[model samples]
Target: METLLPKLDSVFSTDCVIFGFQANELKILLIDRNEEPYKGWRALPGYIVGQDESIDDAAERILYELTGLRGLHMEQFHTFGDVDRHPQGRVITVAYYALIRIDGQQELKPVTNFARAAYWHPVKDLGKLPFDHQKIFETGFRKIRRRLSYQPIAFELLPEKFTLTQLQTLYEAILNRKLDKRNFRKKMLSYGFLKELDEKQKGVSYRAAKLYRFDRRKYNKIFQNDLSVEG
Candidate 1:
């Protein structure tokens, strides 16, 4: 192994931008950097990969160390290898973005010396961020919006049991367009993935709508291979 090794001039790292939906707005988790170059600036939590760790392993390890989260259904969407992406040296970073439902998780308290705090910032009103993160964030947000149109991704962003109105609101927020409720509900219902609960939404002033949950078993059974709609 030593004889087959060639000297390397760069290190690999993974930076994850975790997006969570709450209060009907898109949010991204950022860590306050405590290191130099961009110290005290907010950035996506990331760390250098271990010498023997795989890229996937490094990503999950970085996520857990920063957010106290694991198994986030993460996906590596892009690889950012700009020569100056890192001021430290030649560092190639694999950028990953994920959407983890915040419905049942504990408050994130990132555990790392480089990061002083971890918090969720609304995607709409973020100011300046460290590195090329603003570009990375924009890329991820665009992908999410495009994915929401053809896929039932609202189930991932919403609570366990939500009203159709709430689901439609999520789509509106993502697509930035209002959808006809009758048409939306009709198409959604035709899918047969929503399981109507015997319960109604509580704590609302107006006439409460019934709650429904996404049936994964039925969903997989319905669209097992390709995602398409038939008229």
Candidate 2:
């Protein structure tokens, strides 16, 4: 009789809770798992670690393998290691998050065999998820909310060419607060980071508003100090 291999006590994995904002709504990326334990349920994209690569590299690899996305500018938010988080074995999963414009929804494909299908689910009403995915998503969502306040990260969620309303909506969505139109525009323009272009918003019934681009160089100069972009 052939001898069986011994089991390892620990396993490491990386999970991504990707966020996409469109049409005044936020959605998360979920995959239909084809593996055991949760064969048909929706869950965050994740996979086991590699013996040769570090956790960071593994995260990028797993994300690309499952989502068919590359160069996401990924960020590691937290490390979840609970004894009962996984059903089959002891797994320590590091969760990450990404921001995509979703302008190219067709680009998303399931590259791995484990994921039978990949789709975006609205945040307003999410169904039951596998493992502690719900908790991981809650943590990632809160992290992005805090990051959006200081870092110039909202640009990732916006379109290449956008109007002021679209920009402000991104902020309001993250901050969950209403902002004064005049005050907000005045303050935002005063910073000089937004360059007013000759472009105007089209397809609107009302007076068309001018379009602008966020200036990276000017942004660094104005708020070089520990300034905050609250919400």
Candidate 3:
């Protein structure tokens, strides 16, 4: 006897929730769709995964094509496979998230036909996004919030050399609450992964805060261990 399965129309897609900390706020990269189903609507940077391409490779290609950004570390976070997620067909999307420092040198001119433009929107102010993207962003945000307690991923969103206050601001932006300044500083410094540099913040009207860098060498040695903190 031979068994047959129904014809499958399923396909894969990659959605990226690229987070960045700028102006002391947490923002996610979004694209304005140029084509329908939801033309002109804001959406996460995403595209269908090619049949001949690996999902990771597709993610990189899609991100670069849609946002004109490259070399940022994107990590797979979740998979959204709801039957009604996509309008045209069965698109089971694998969601990836990345934390990048928003530098003035990096321009956000999208080079894709699917998007009219690419821009960063504050995570708190992102009004109803298209195609379950709001849900995707919410999930990614939660993952980062939970991961922050144990991982040093926050460093990715800060400048190469940042002040302790800047670091706290990034954390508060992600956590969406005020953290104990003294406790936050003490806990972070106790980790021994922050390298204090002789440099200080410049061009600010107030007193210049001393700068610190995340020591990757010490981070590597302590990667297995984690410093937990509360907001």
Whose lDDT is greatest here? Answer: 3
- lDDT by candidate, in order shown: 0.81, 0.81, 0.90
For residues 36-109, write the lDDT of model 1, one tens digit per residue. Answer: 87989988888889889999999998988877777777888888888888887888888888877776876677
Worst 10 residues of 3 by lDDT: 222-231
Q: Give the TM-score of candidate 3.
A: 0.93
lDDT of 2 at 109: 79
Sort by lDDT, best first.
3, 2, 1
Itemize residue pairs with steric clashes in candidate 1: none
**Model 3, range 1-231, lDDT digits (tens) per residue?**
899999876699999999998888889999999998999999999999998999999999999899889877899999999989989977899999998889853688788789889988998898998999989999999999989877888998998999999999988888888889999999889888999999999999999999999998888886657657763
Instruction: State the weakest 10-residue window (summed lDDT) of model 2.
Output: 222-231
Q: What is the lDDT of residue 45 in candidate 3?
A: 96
TM-score of each: 0.88, 0.86, 0.93
Which whole-number lDDT from 0 to 100 does residue 66 have in model 2?
76
RMSD of each: 3.0, 4.8, 1.8
Q: Taking the tens digit of each residue's C-alpha lDDT, what string does model 2 give over 1-231?
A: 999989856689999989888886677888888898899888999989988889889988887777777777678899999999999878999998889888874567778898888777888677788999999989998998887756777877777777788877777776767777776667667667778899998898999988888787888877654324433
lDDT of the structure predicted as candidate 2:
0.81
